[model samples]
Target chain A: MHTAGVTLQQVAQQAGVSLATASRVLHGSGSRTVGEELRRRVEAAAQELRYVSNAPAQALARATSDVVGLIVHDVADPYFGAIAAGAMRAAREQRLMVMIAATFREPGLELEYLRSLRAQRARAVILAGSGTADADATARLAEEIAGFEADGGRVVCVGERGPDLDTVVMANRGGGGLAARGLWDLGHRRIGVVSGPAELLTVRHRLDGARRALRSLGAPLAPDAVTVGDFTREGGRVAAVRLLRARPDLTAVLVLNDVMAAGALAGLRDDLGLAVPDRVSVVGFDDVPFAADLRPALSTVRLPLEAAGEAAVRLLLEPSGDEPRRVALAAELVLRDSTATTVG
Target chain B: MHTAGVTLQQVAQQAGVSLATASRVLHGSGSRTVGEELRRRVEAAAQELRYVSNAPAQALARATSDVVGLIVHDVADPYFGAIAAGAMRAAREQRLMVMIAATFREPGLELEYLRSLRAQRARAVILAGSGTADADATARLAEEIAGFEADGGRVVCVGERGPDLDTVVMANRGGGGLAARGLWDLGHRRIGVVSGPAELLTVRHRLDGARRALRSLGAPLAPDAVTVGDFTREGGRVAAVRLLRARPDLTAVLVLNDVMAAGALAGLRDDLGLAVPDRVSVVGFDDVPFAADLRPALSTVRLPLEAAGEAAVRLLLEPSGDEPRRVALAAELVLRDSTATTVG
Candidate 1:
């Protein structure tokens, strides 16, 4: 009655040992040990029978499985892809298989996935999605997380979600400041901002930092100078066009992320017929892969994406103390060919 | 007694129903039905007790699981990311969780991941990595696939692996032909080929297709004109440098992939101080997301990567017949600004 090839019962019968002894020798958790002769017999019998160990049964015998769940907003996005790769690398070292689900920026889907991971008895879950500003959704998510933790599953969020949860926080606001200040130092006075959805905490923090930095430099960013995109390349392009059309006096624009920055670069040259650095300088955040491949290359704030993912996984595996743990990652601005002194 | 919160037995007791009735009601495979009154009581008791269903136990009872495995060479690569996004989209529709493993191009790691997925009794596995030319490794992989299928697990390969298995084959050779013809039509006769590892079947097929296409045009590709890279941007840059130093007469180069083509562009302009499409022309395969954002854009062959991923998942969910299923995808040439006519 084995759906997974030969069963352990057959192996035990062939080896002439008790079922407990056969299991102890084959898939034991290392706390128990079997005699060498018995273990050899069991292993040989397993090979002869071509037996495949049932992980479900083993997981039932223990309390949990080797699987860890990783939830992201979009796996196809290079930001999430880099993080998943790093998380997978760390999971490999822990001998844990990672099950990933893309929520596509839907808060409902994120909650559903957490419940599913909890049901699967996943050892831990890494929440790599951005925090939504919806209070109701956040409260519901916090409750669901409590349920998951109650069931012995650990969770580590990659960004700011809520209080009392382990998190690997990126210096998003600081990065925004760096992007603005870099442009300011290049003699760019009238600078515009291209941002993503205001509902995202990341977007809010980054915009706040840019506005503050610009205000201190005596060129306060006007509300009309900021245009919102959907955090996509196309959205960035559309927003850049709208912003530049309205504020023709601006000499530079600060994009919230690299993807949008790439779009702004295209819009500035192809749409508006303006040369970069000579007509308009651009700065972007997140310095994702291929940032340097763009025309004139991109000057962006470097966020250690892979390291953030690795840190989240590490926090999940570490022992929990009385308080939630936080790992702060710093963002640095990298100057490239995209930015230059603004010429009149 | 209940590691995952309240157990089914406790719910059964609270609902005043038989253990069998509780099992048939909650987490049932839908083959049996319980009385409406009993189902209501069970639902109420489950909510009150905060019972979390055990997926492992459910999998054991059903002899299968709702989890599918996806194996890739690298997840950080945008090519794989696009595919994964498609696969995840399809999996979400099917209400299945996908566990992804990156083998990092290691044959041993691929095999190990396969066994792990099998042990977990995953519903199916999608092999998205390129096939290796190693005979021993292929044989071993085939044997493992045989064992996995025998245990009631479905296997679907994304690209060419071996015979007698379902696959969603991308037109690698045809794509290569398209790239070569696109360049030939532009009057580039003295052409060079930049490629990845020769051990990959994809690389071999692509190179063969280009060689055949060029041969038909009476400009046969010479062995000395082809350079091998590690399928990375840096590798492509170094290979382009070496090729130009050796064969200065070549007016164009066909890069195997877009990532490498990006590097070749940088090398041609920065290292060699040559103008694109003026002093040299270049063509790449796989019109990835950032192809258009690159300077002068990239002329390449477009492969429907996301559709390929969706098709694999669809194949896995469909019932298997006597004959193995195959889905062939066509690759088309996309002309951008990267290539131009050869000038003296």
Candidate 2:
């Protein structure tokens, strides 16, 4: 007898079936292949014996649970929402339940969630967000990932890279450079940037790339023209207002992400009374779905956010050896009516 | 010896402490009140014995899991996204992990997800979406929820009412009536309706209420005026195009939700070259965050979606008797630039 006081072999004998057939019936699998009569008989035998399968025990024996743990910075943001949809699609295909936790961009909360996921013995843990520049937090996260892997758990990151872990890296730098070059080529010399939080590696990398492009075009970016916010729509609006106030001569503005860009556009038009592409051109990154529907349509860089999410899950499910796998997605600039030649 | 080969008494004896102290330290609770020296001694004793706490076994003993399960129609939609954020906040306060599953508006998938959540032994399950009109699907869901409750699980529905289950009901009918009357007061005699999937109870209720209000104003709604889609932006766009093509003489349009309203506005301006509130007035339900940011500013009925989500969680966590609890939230109309006096 097992811990539940009834063994599979005994149930099979009582049901006049083989152990494999009884196991299949009890596990709720291979129902189509087995005869209905036999299946009913096995189920009845198990019921008569008061058999109850302990799921956590079974999971412990297999060293894995059916749950896939996903950590995101915030689910309210459209960018994360799109990525989560793609990840959930992949998870559904694999018949896995997803346990999601939002950190709200707090590095400490991210680490805490990792520990909780590890304790739950999740099949895989996917960290979906930009990496924090804090050294202590990074070290703590690396340690947690290493410990999880040592216990035979898989870890994959989307849009973030960690030490010796698989990652789906979005082309934030290249996308930023493309946006800068697109605006500069349009005779936009005096441009402002609506940047997200300065501590995020994503914000830093994109800003650095944009600055590099500006220098290459003989238009050095003014240090005072860069305004920072929380990477939200409201943040974009606030930053845009600050930028306009600091430099009214600016002919164009580049937002870090499409959401913030939407805010910047609204601020420019509603608050500043500026006509898009006529008085002040606007460029954004990450061509979200609504970008094309916005008034005048937003010109932005397209990042394969959904595809990257899928790739992260795929990497987590695939077998791995010593070295970690890496997948880098490209970002392209999509021109729309939001950008045009600077008015003389 | 217990299942793990060591007992709390053994650790207590090894640490030269009381059994309660050892139990508290081993469970990792009350550490703040317990002395540091005593806590370290108990931990060392546990380490020496290589003790591991079986969380699921303990949960089974207590007849509860630490995880909360949430089911949504679609997470990518901003409406659901906002609700999820509110639900997450409530769950966070209880230190519970949330397992989220999206059914994509599939009734079969909804039932299947509930079963999966039950198998995982979730503490509580929150179903957040409009109930389907399919009798068979609704009956199956009710049965599943009943079985879960019988097994000591809690079930709560948000914006959906199941047979004798706790529900957080949004005032869809009243909200729809308010929008219709608001338009009627503005002298909009001929108005088109962009409704969601006809199978959703929310759609039927809202449409019925709007038609009732229209009749009261002596402007009976034509059966052909209602166009249905999947409650999505693209669906709204298609429905708007069809509405315009079929009834070009209409003076106003009311969408079932803000997302579809945004789509209808885009279709009107981009495809039909119609100016909002000038050529034809527009109104939407569910004033999502971006509704006010849209060009011309959408006039919408505001539903406390996030608050409803929070209420659902609260209902699920509270103890209930044979009688189930119900919370109904009020919806109000917010006037904006999208609606105005009909042009001559």
> Against the true structure, whose TM-score is highest?
1
Error of 1 at B307 (Å): 0.1
Q: Write the per-residue lDDT of candidate 1 for residues B163-207, one digit (tens) a residue.
A: 798999999999988889888888888899999899888888888
Stretches off by above 4 angstroms in model 1 are A1-4, B1-4
Model 2 lDDT at residue B112: 88
Highest DockQ: give the candidate number: 1
Q: Against the true structure, candidate 1 has what lDDT? A: 0.89
TM-score of each: 0.97, 0.91
Residues B44-121 of candidate 2 have per-residue lDDT tens digits of: 998886444545554545456688899998777888888898888888888888999999888899988987887677
lDDT tens readout by residue for model 1, A1-344: 12746789999999999999998998786999999999999999999887888888778778788999999999888888889988999989989999999998899999999999988999889999688899999999999898888888898999888779999999988888888998998998899999999989889989998999999988899999999998899999999999999999999899998999999999989999989878888888888889999987999989899999888889988876779999999999998888889863
User: What TM-score does each model's chain B reach against the true chain B?
Assistant: 0.96, 0.88
